[model samples]
Target: MLRTDEILSTIQMLHAEHLDVRTVTMGVNIQDCASADVEAMCRKLRHKLTSRASRLVETCDRVGGKYGLKVTNKRLAISPVAHLLSGHDLNAAVAVAKTLDQAAAEVRVDLIGGFSALVHKGISSGDKVVIDALPAVLSQTQRLCASVNAASRRAGINMDAVRLLGEQIKAIAEATADRQGFGAAKLVVFANIPEDNPFMAGAYLGDGEPEVVINVGVSGPGVVSSALKRRLELEPNLTLGELAEEIKLTAFRVTRAGELIGREVATELGIPFGIVDLSLAPTPEIGDSVGEILQLLGLDAIGAPGSTAAVALLNDAVKKGGAFASSSVGGLSGAFIPVSEDAALADAATRGHLTLEKLEAMTSVCSVGLDMIAIPGDTPAETIAAIMADELAIGVINNKTTAVRLIPVPGKKAGDRVDFGGLFGSAPVMPVRNPGASSRFVRFGGRIPAPIQSLSN
Candidate 1:
């Protein structure tokens, strides 16, 4: 099973393309950390997390250095704390979030997800607690992130949960207004959310997953963009299909590198390896932008006329390449178009080249939806629900995962700038027309039926 030349070639391709493993997320099921007594539960939660994830970030860095690859974030995901704190009050639920944040800091991980609730059908007592605590928990916590799954292909959309989350989002923004509504940055509302996703603001240790597992998120926007550039220069008349094939091949190599590193790290830590999430997650950096990749695909700008088709091609090629690379590939492994997180996207939004509607259109073909988008503080909650409903409808109809992380900058208007700093970046608050008039539609609280695709045997 040894091939020296093949290994060397893989390394060369990685180095040349500027590809690297984006994150090594360890999912630690903390359902067992729950107890009838609050103090006992906190103790169990701390002990389990510290024991399982004590060396996660450190080991990831060590492994990355050893392979001459960079591991950008080492993260942890736990079971939905809402379910664990069902009998507890909102204060108790917030305490659980605090424990998660402290544990994450002790482990030195960048972020800890799973302050979550899955209320696609109906809300539970724990779900209410978590939802109510979101304003405080998000504003108070440092590294903890939260996600709420309000819709699924099988269960349809929960209009009640959607409406509530819309209000909760506003509250969260108001609670952290002084910090640019940074609390909203840590929360995401999703449709058809993936369980084993290694990405933040959404990743959660699903009930079906093992006690502890390693999930890798591999990113390669730069790699694919560079490959396309070289191919375009070499064959000026190459078809779009040929260009996509080249991108797929490059993604295959990148996925291979991720799988190899993930397995090694899992084996060394004596834990089960979950899957390789081959999402082309971009950063605020120049060359690493997914919007830049779209520009390379001949688009005049990121949100131009042919932008949706270009995204469709890029997402399809990335999935095909990742699927070919490893049988263990899972999670939302497609192109992410977060406006604030990608420099080019932020520029486009600031220059009025990209709008909220165009971003929604692109999310239909891409992985995540309306990510890191900032809007006016006065944008009505009903408008947020309408936005979430539109994206979730796309996910339900297509049977894909889509999510929203909208930041409503307090006291800020469309032209105002909100800086979240670091990986979240900064963006001009985009305008949303007719921010009212959706409340009546949202108030008819019932589930949106699943699409025909869910009838599969």
Candidate 2:
């Protein structure tokens, strides 16, 4: 049983901090909708989404209104579309993506994830269909998002899939060149992608999850930064240990607030509540930035020498706090440094303070890797694959969830600004240091063997 007073106490702290649930994603298993006939499959898919997610927005609003905690985005995640795409053609893949878009629009969700393929070990026929259709599907759809898992801790990295995705990603970008490669923004490449993440461009109903569930994404970069600042004002000479404690406590309270609302919304919809992802996901808003938190931690610049250590500390502290707050804490529960989505981080990129290499190093210790970064449009596909290989190598070796969401902005050069607007924000394109130097390396494509660490038994 939940105590309203205790819950209200949690909500009070969130209200004061001006914190809100970043997303409330309903995960639905749609594999049962698969059919040999493409038309029938799409029909079933649309009906299933509409039926399952029709009341998601309404329920979230009512539940949030009860505590004055706004649910910023309502969305959905479905079982990987690849499983249903088997025996289907590339055109069928586009049709399915279009159906997903229509369903999302009908249900009032911001975006829907799971037009995805899990090719960590090998690419199946269905996976090929999803990859091949990216150019057309992404260009035509509005609210559809896609992801490809090309590497994993247990299976090592699939260089073949990574290389293929590099080529396909560029095609998707060119297909949407009018929008500054925005289509690529909707697709992410991952190593060890989470099953129940409520965030976009990667969330999906992975195997072993419930048929229907509600997952929550609650990010409070502003709240965490404010808490640290207050602590600093009181004890101007506080040690890093003490400041980390402040961040941990702030994360605990924030997790509690997010989980309570998630459970209430789940109950209203008569579905099981899933995990609360307590990532410090930043926004373009001035005060809401993970980089600013780094600055508060005494870094004069965002990407200074000790930036990786600072990110390591923040990620560890955030996870510890969320874990202590709820046993249901799951997903990527740490600090995210998506460049364009974070105002301070974007400024640092523009001023040459943050480079792609520095971002990769930080991602080794941060929650997600090299997210929302814009690169020169003319970058070679081999270079893109090499960049992904580096980032995924971190996740594969460290056994953490790391992903890449790079936007190859067409006709844009290094240091050129791109305004994606809204939560997507904007960033000056960061130069890829060695454009085609790694072609020989990526061309020798094969599975990079799993580390000895995978023999955990």
Candidate 3:
């Protein structure tokens, strides 16, 4: 259906700008793997995951090679273990987590999410157990990822659940202190968590999803940045609207490429295609970064004065383009600004050009909130809670999905480096000036009432 010129442009963009499908995530519901006997349940869970995902990574890689596209990650997301752990003890939950970890390793997937709980309203017994087991489970396992939905637009923010999660996050941090609380890197606390996300540590198979499905996350920050740079070079007086249109057209091509790859993978794997997550996920690579896109928008540095506006424009344009390209687009399909993952952002943090406050401001328009950020090791639990509360408040008020994945590197002071290695690049431990000052405010814990707009429905 593409014209000759458009097709050539797409090929040029892909080759020059590092455009590629970011992730091919398989969602597998594990509720049916539950059983009265803990051992039986764990065995079933392990077997099912191993059988289903054994060829996932291989298939994705093979397909990527055929199209000359790089599939960055192959992952699995299962039903929240909390619902399946109802009436089971903490030991049982850990056992299930071990099964998940083993299965992930056996199948050679990078990460497996859904050590999760949906407690936006209140915590059930199962939710409490899964939360309590997090510190031990995450510290003990390697590939399993966890998330908790502590707030939602319709149900309001559960301050009690948020408080508990804050404490749990601290415990997880302390437990993995040797790795600078890198265990917490595998966990996310969210507001209005999406069910079909293919990225982690936020991806989880929600209760309403089917038995098995394939969800794709397509990334093209480099592609967008290249387009913006070209436009600016040609027309210095290009309006913001014109810049956005350029991004939209580039995003449209990227989304189409992802849809083609994802559907092909799904068909080969014999699973229903879920959605395409048209998120501009970044990496530590030089040209493949969301922060570079911000820089291309004329900011000398990523967190400068105009950074948030640039991110807002980029996010909106990417969403608009993806929506036009595919009716099945879902997840946090916008620009992601994970601190450690983007080299420019990391450099800005090291140079003191970016701060936690600026990152928080940028999250208002970005896909994920406060992602892969490392703070001072001695940061108080109350401050972490306040940070999360602020981010969740934004999502609740705006009726969008937002999450916090803060890493409190134990024993590391401000400006210290915490190296996570691989795609979770190293981050300088940023200072948190006022740590425990928010304790009194957080102690008066109850539901933060829903925003006025939420009541209209």
Candidate 4:
């Protein structure tokens, strides 16, 4: 039970600080909706999604209002669409995607995830079909989000799938050229992707999850930063280790608030409460930026030296606090440094202070990898594959989740600005150092064997 003082503190956070539940995602298993006939499968899928998620948005709003908390997004994550595409072709995949879009619209959810394929080791026939259909599937749909897990700790990296996704990302860019290749922004290429993440475009109902579950994502970089600023103002002599402890305490309160909301939602929906994702997911809004937290940690700029260590400190403190607050903590529960989504990070990139190399280094310690980054449109497919390989290798070796959401804006060159608008934000197209140099390396398509750590029993 929260003390009276604690309750008032939370109220202050809600009203003043940018502290609110980021997303309340409900995962719905759709494997039972599959059928051998394409039309039958689509019909079943549509019915299942509609029946399951019809009340999601309403319930989220109702419960959030009950607590005076705003649930920014109500989302749905279904089982991997590749499983539903068994014995299907590209046409079937597109049809299924359209069905998903229609169902999501009818249910009034913000985004519908799980138009995804998990081919970490090898691509199944269905996985290949989904990959081939992505350019059309993503371009033609608004609310549909997709992901492809091309690497894992045990199975290592699937260079073949990586190469395919890189090629298709370019195709997706061309298909949505009028929208500045915004379709690519809806797709993520992941390594060691978690099964229970509440965030998109990487969320899916993994095989081990329940038939239906509610997961909450709590994001408050601003709240964290404010707490740190207040502490420094009050006690300027505090050491870095003491400052980290303060962060943990603030995160504990945030996670408790999120869990309270999630459990209430789950109970109302008659589903199991899954987990609370304690990611410090930032936005384009000022003061609500992960980069600002790094600045508070004394970094001259986000990409300056010691930035990686600073991020590691913040990520670790957040995780420790969330874990202690909730035993069910899961998902990517750390700092997310999506470039365009965070105003400070976007500015850093625009000013050339944060290069792709520095961002990659930072991802080694952050929650996600190379997120919301806009690159030159003409960047080579091979080069894109190489980028994925390098980032995924970090996750594979470290045994953690990492993903890439690279948007190659069509017709835009380095230093040009591409505006995606809304929470997607805008960014200057950063240059890729070696445009076509990785062609041969990425073409050697095979698995990069798992690191020695995988041998642990």
Per-residue alpha-carbon lDDT of model 3 for 137-157, expressed as tens digits? 999999999999999998888
> What is the lDDT for 180 in model 3?
79
Give the winner by lDDT: 1 or 3. 3
TM-score of each: 0.96, 0.97, 0.96, 0.98
* Model 2, span 162-275: residue lDDT tens: 999999888999999999999999999999999999999899999999999999999999899888888899899999999889999989988988999999999999999999
For candidate 4, list the clashing residue pairs, or say none: none
lDDT of 4: 0.92
In order, candidate lDDTs are 0.90, 0.93, 0.91, 0.92
* Residues 93-138 of candidate 4: C-alpha lDDT, one tens digit per residue: 9999999999999998889899999999999988988999999999
> How does candidate 4 fare on TM-score?
0.98
lDDT (Cα, 0-100) at 389 in candidate 2: 93
User: For model 2, what is the alpha-carbon lDDT of residue 309?
Assistant: 93
- Name the TM-score of candidate 3: 0.96
| Candidate whose lDDT is highest | 2
Error of model 1, residue 427, in angstroms: 1.2
What candidate 3 gets wrong by more than 4 Å, as runs, is: 1-8, 454-457
Task: Give the per-residue Cα lDDT of candidate 1 at 127.
Answer: 94
Predicted structure 3: lDDT:
0.91
Model 1, span 256-284: residue lDDT tens: 88998899889889999999999999988
